[model samples]
Target chain A: MTVPALSVQGLTTHFFTRAGVVKAVDGVSFDLAQGEIMGLVGESGSGKTVTGFSLLGLVDPPGRIVEGSIKLNGTELTTLSGSALRARRGREISMIFQDPIATLNPLLTIGQQMQLAIAAHERLGKRAALARCTELLTQVGIPSAEARLRAYPHEFSGGMRQRVAIAIALLHRPAVLVADEPTTALDVSIQAQILLQMRELAAETGTAMIWISHDLAVVSSLATKLAVMYAGKIVEQGPTAALLRDPRHPYTAGLIASLPAMTTPGTPLTQIRGTTPSLLSLPPGCPFAPRCDKQTEACVQKPAMTLDGPRGWRCFHPVGQTAGAPT
Target chain B: MLGFIIQRFIQAVGVMAVMSVIVFFGVYAIGNPIDIVIPPDATQEIRLEAIRRLGLDRPLYEQYFTFLANLLQGDLGRSFVYNMPVLELIGGRLPATLELVLISVISATVLGVSLGIYAGYRPDSWVSKTIMAVSVLGFSVPSFWVGLILILFFAVHLGWLPAGGRGDTVMIWGVAWSFPTLNGLSHIALPAVNLALFKLAMMIRLARAGTREIMLTDTIKFARAAGLSEATILRRHLLKLISIPIITVFGLELGSTLAFAVVTETIFSWPGVGKLIIDSIAVLDRPVMVAYLILVAFLFVTINFVIDLVFALIDPRVRDGASA
Candidate 1:
């Protein structure tokens, strides 16, 4: 079989704070084929964004990738560091951030920022770079690419700034793009438009994506697969429709049940019983135990990942199963 | 933009108008200069003649209007001590202070920003810690004491440079500039450095704080994710983002240092406007005092205006607001 576009196995990243070590991303593993979009779903502090940052080697000090293998089309990324790793970043796998307002430099024009990004990896001539920049902008549905390039980030509306950010991220047309809630700060209508555009772009460019967001509904519309994280671990992952329809992890069940669409229109929405545990002091086995209604004594020891074809989960007593049923 | 400049200009004029009134009466309250101009032993005829010659025998309001009238006529009267036009006396001494302060402030900004960025970028490094320690010393040490120490070490102990004075000069644009000659440069070095220490510390603190904050921003992070080198990120993004505060402090320091490099000037025996102002105050030279104070007010207004224009140039957000 042809190699997957991106493969991550046993990824673990930790932040050494004075209080304690924060296991931001612990043993996250997944694979994305060309053109596939994987939605990494988690609440705040659940390690989804950290996973995205780790993929690009962008974690700052006091935080480090303690162990992992992140391979881009069969080329190992963890082995590279400094300039070598940076060279691979935008050219091989780039990322888009949550807030367009804060991500783009206020002092620089869109054209200059794009040029700077382009110059980072290649030595393109001015005319050629301009042509490429205009093409990318137009492709991202920005009208008047020529004049828009000279505009500052503030000149663009919130949605338009995100489009500019997307255009810049797509400059090198890398194999993978990790988007960290690129639409969370946008209006709902704008978010829908961007989601549709991003879906089309991924298909047209054949670029794999790891779309990180807490809004399961938003991700379900755009992503083919999903991974649910809790306390730095991926508790369950599978094809999006299958996992949403038949969530085997209690945490996933609570997330799906809490959605407004899933609840009776006038009734209170379902929510997990307890808050997420602090990463610094997670329980030895089953970080979700305190909040998992189906939690069993067997959960006192960590459950090995149970898999069926493309679907998998890490729970001793999963949803739809009696608490003491055979493993 | 034109409206903005015009508004600033009108504001500057109003400020000068107010300053002139304040300076006139303020000097009047500082005891009559006639006391110093005419000795106690002088005869009544000599004293009256001295008061008449100095325009002091006129009523207070009459004297003020006369001074104001002369001011509008491109004259500041004559300095009683120097026996020359007040404007000419100040103009002659301004070049020395201008060159000295310009060199020091500019050098301080450049060196401080570079060091500050390094310290902020690598805050955990020992070098950064050392830089921060030195900056603290810079803030605490008195400038006069520092000037004396600088002289004692670089001049007296090392004997590598002169102890005081503007050593030699080259005439440029009808003004004597000490920067051109080797001897003059050596003479200006200690005093410039002495003046720079406090400002350097301030700049370092400001820039360091700005850099530290900006480095954590998504702007810098986004730049890095796009594979921009660390140096390029620092230069293009971090520098521009941190520059507004640095520029503000730079302008303020430049004005303040120019107005009050008195201690360093005194220590170095540099014949700048600071020295000239001190001597005028010693003998209570009224014309020189009023003119000097007004000139200082004008300098501050002009510097602030220039800083506003510069802010617009560097930041597009400011430019948009300025136009509106």
Candidate 2:
């Protein structure tokens, strides 16, 4: 079989704070074929963002990838460090962040910043670099791409800045692109536009993506596959259509049920009970057991991930198994 | 941008106007220079002549207006001690101070910012701790005492440099410069280091604080994610981010040091404006005192204006704010 674009298995990242070891991302595993989009879904603090950072080896001090195997196009990345890892980052696997305003350097113009990114890996002539920057900007739907390159981050509106950030991320058109809530800070109209553009770009470039977000409607609209994370672990994952139609994990079911589209107008939307367990002091066995409506004696002991072809979940009593149980 | 510059220039003129008033009245309050200018044994006629000739015999308001009128005419009156124009007297001594203060502040900024960035980048390292410790010592030690110690260590003990005074001079563009000759460089060294000590500490602290904050920003993270090396990130991204505050302190320190590097100057006996001002004070030279104080105010206003422009140049946000 052809190698997948990105493969991650048993990835465990932890923050070694003074309080304790906080497992930010624990045992996350997924694979994305070329040009595929995998939506990493979770609430805040669910390790989705950390997972994305782990993929790029971008976790700062006090937090690090303590254990993991992140392979990009069958080349192991966890073993790479320092310059080796840095070389691979933007050239092979790039990432765009959540807030465009905060991500781009305020002091630098878009042209200068894009040029710097280009210069980091290859030595391109000045004319070629400018031409490449313009092409990427135009591709990303930035109007007057040539003139816009001279504009600073503050000069661009929120959406425009994010578009610039995306253009930078796609400069080399790496095999894997990990976007962390890139469109969340944008308006709905802009968000839809970016999402559609991103899908087209991924298809054209054959770049796989792990789109991390908490917004189910936004994710479901774009992602081909879905992975639901709760308390630093993936509880359910499968094709987007199959998972949404039949959420095997109770937490995933709750997330699907809470979406505005899933509920009648004016009715109270369903929400998962309780906040995520603190990573510093997680409950033994299943971390989400405290909030699970189908919690049983078996939940006291963590259930192994049960798989059916491409679909898999870690639940003792999955949704359909508990028919007539509390929704 | 032109409007902003014009507005700043008007504000600078307003500042100079207020500074002139304060200096004129303040010098007037320091007792009539005639008492010190004329000998006590001088006859009443001689005393009267001296007072009239010096413009001290006029009413305080008239004397202030005379000073302002003379200032507008580019004549800061004649120095009673030197019998030369006050501006000419100051201009003769200013180059010495300018060269010394420039060397000290520029070297301090370059060295301090580099060390500070390194310290901030690796705060837990022993080198950072040592740098911090040295900065604290720099802040706490008085400049006069530091000046003496510097003399003792470099001049007396090591015998590697001169103890005091501008040793030799070479004329450049009709100005006596001590920097050209090795002997002059040796002479200026101790005094410059002594003047730079406190400012170095300040720059280090400012840069360290700025770097520590900016290092954690998403801007740095994004740069790193773009595969920019740590050195590039620090130089290109961190430096620009931290430069506004550092440049502000640099301008302030440069002005303050140029205006009031008295303790170090006195210790080294370097013939700069600081010495000139002290000597003028002793002789109750009103013209020199008034002119010097006004010049100090003008220097500060000009430096601050330049710094604002620099802030605009480095940061588009500041540029927008200024034009708006």
Candidate 3:
């Protein structure tokens, strides 16, 4: 269907470590239709950012995409050469880093930084490139962007810098934007503002987004579809409302329950016991079985994703009786 | 910024003050001038009178004040050995020394930085390995030794240029704009090259290290992912990050070049402050000796300040902070 704006199938990324080969992304798969926002939600080390970095070919040595078909608009990105991948990045498929401070070059003025990104993908002269830089900055809701162009990264407050970074990423109007924890480092108020700006921009540009975060609330607010990952696999995924309304994986229930809410204050918050297992020593059965509250004998040998109803789940006895209002 | 400048100037003064003390004592520390002037047997009263007239009988502090006053007034006192104004003696030799140091600094900075960027960009490659090999060679060999070897092979043996002296005596100021000598440059050239060789190695090594560090930065990796060309990456991103360390090392190298000029000047028989100080000290020409010592100290401080400015220009953080 319209080649899905982005399609990932049987995607796996592994890291060869002294301990062992860690399967960080064990055959995780998903799709994002054009203009769709896909929320890839997980706690730390769930391979969410890794997956995003992989899509843009940002994974460095030691960690590699061993098996995967990452296609954007039907053009395969996984197999692209280094130069070709770079050309696509920030131009056709850009990334907004979790800590924008780390993402931006501190030495250059915003204008120079934006011009560099624009020049990397476009054939325009510096004068034209600067004009477009101001336009993008203005589009991202940065006031007085023309004057701000001369200001370096350090001068801009944290939220402002992230906006400038976002402006730079959108300078060439990429089709896909991968935002990795774009709000995690910001103050709550600033985070809300930046997120709002991003949502508006996504709508205005019709950019397909892979929003990666541990905060399901934030994701649910922005993404129509959601994938919950544990250890290194997507244990459950479906339409955001359906998954939130009736999460089918015990771990998914634990995550949703753990989220702060008005209704759950009196109900002792549910927590998935134990940490996500180390990838090197992942249980032979389901990676989350050691921590899954609904584990059984069938969980000892890993339950493969079974198509049940409208979503996918990797549980022998899938979670039943979704959250209901006792009307 | 005013505070920084004032502080730096105070530090410079302190250095000059110490250098003056050492110059004053050490320059006059040797045996009395009478021994060399009159066969060591001049009548005691005559020698005493000579000393008194020359103000040698004054207390050390008084003599120091006199020397300071003379220096402030641009009269570097008198060179007892040269029998001329101390300022004139240094003035005569200053150009030769400046020329040598300029050539050496330029050579080391260009060669060292180029080699460093290349080695860093191609670590473990044959080109990098070759550069490392050459750097090791350049580092271990002493500059004087390098000079000797150059003289032996290129000058004495090959006879391409004059073996010594600022060219033949005939060419000395024969033309208003002409330099020390045609033959003399062959000698000066080797010595200058020798002086710069160590700095070349240092620059390359430091540059390579800094470049490698810069290369590891996420922004650089991001730049690479964004499809920047290798040339653009190296020139715009790589070089800027390494400028601070390179400038730092280069400043130190420049200071050492001033210090080492004495040795190089002696080797080539070029009349620079290095040789001027030595010749003054040999016969206890205290004024010229003090002048040259203070001059070298001044050169070191001034060069370091300029290097700081260069570093600030390269790193915006520093520049903004300093300006702020």
Q: Score the docking of each candidate (DockQ).
A: 0.87, 0.85, 0.48
Q: Would you give me the overall lDDT of model 1?
A: 0.93
RMSD of each: 1.1, 1.9, 4.3
Compare candidates 2 and 3 on DockQ and give the better one: 2
Candidate 1 regions with alpha-carbon error over 4 angstroms: A322-327
TM-score of each: 0.99, 0.98, 0.88
Ranking of predictions according to lDDT = 1, 2, 3
**iRMS values for every prediction:** 0.6, 0.8, 1.9
**Stretches of candidate 3 above 4 Å error?**
A17-20, A262-269, A300-302, A308-310, A321-327, B1-41, B122-126, B129-142, B145-189, B264-271
Better of 1 and 3 by TM-score: 1
Question: In TM-score terms, which candidate is top?
Answer: 1
Which docking class does model 1 fall in? Answer: high
After superposition, the stretches of candidate 2 with alpha carbons farther than 4 Å from their true spots are: A322-327
What's candidate 3's i-RMS value?
Answer: 1.9
**Model 2 iRMS:** 0.8
| Model 3 lDDT tens row, A1-327 | 367888899889988877789888889888888677888999899888788878887775578999989988889988888777777887788878777777677777888777777778778987788789889889988899899999888888889878887787777788888888888889989988877777788888988888899999888988888999887789998999999998888888888878878244677766767987777888888888788666677777777887756588877767785432212
Question: Per-residue CA lDDT of candidate 2, range B1-324, in tens?
Answer: 888999999999999998998888988788878878889999999988888888777888998898888889888888998999988888989989999999999999999998898889899999999999999999999999999889899999999999998989999888899999999998999999998888889888988999999999888888888889998999899999999999999999999999988878889998899999999999999899999999999999989999999999999998998889
Sorted by TM-score (best first), the order is: 1, 2, 3
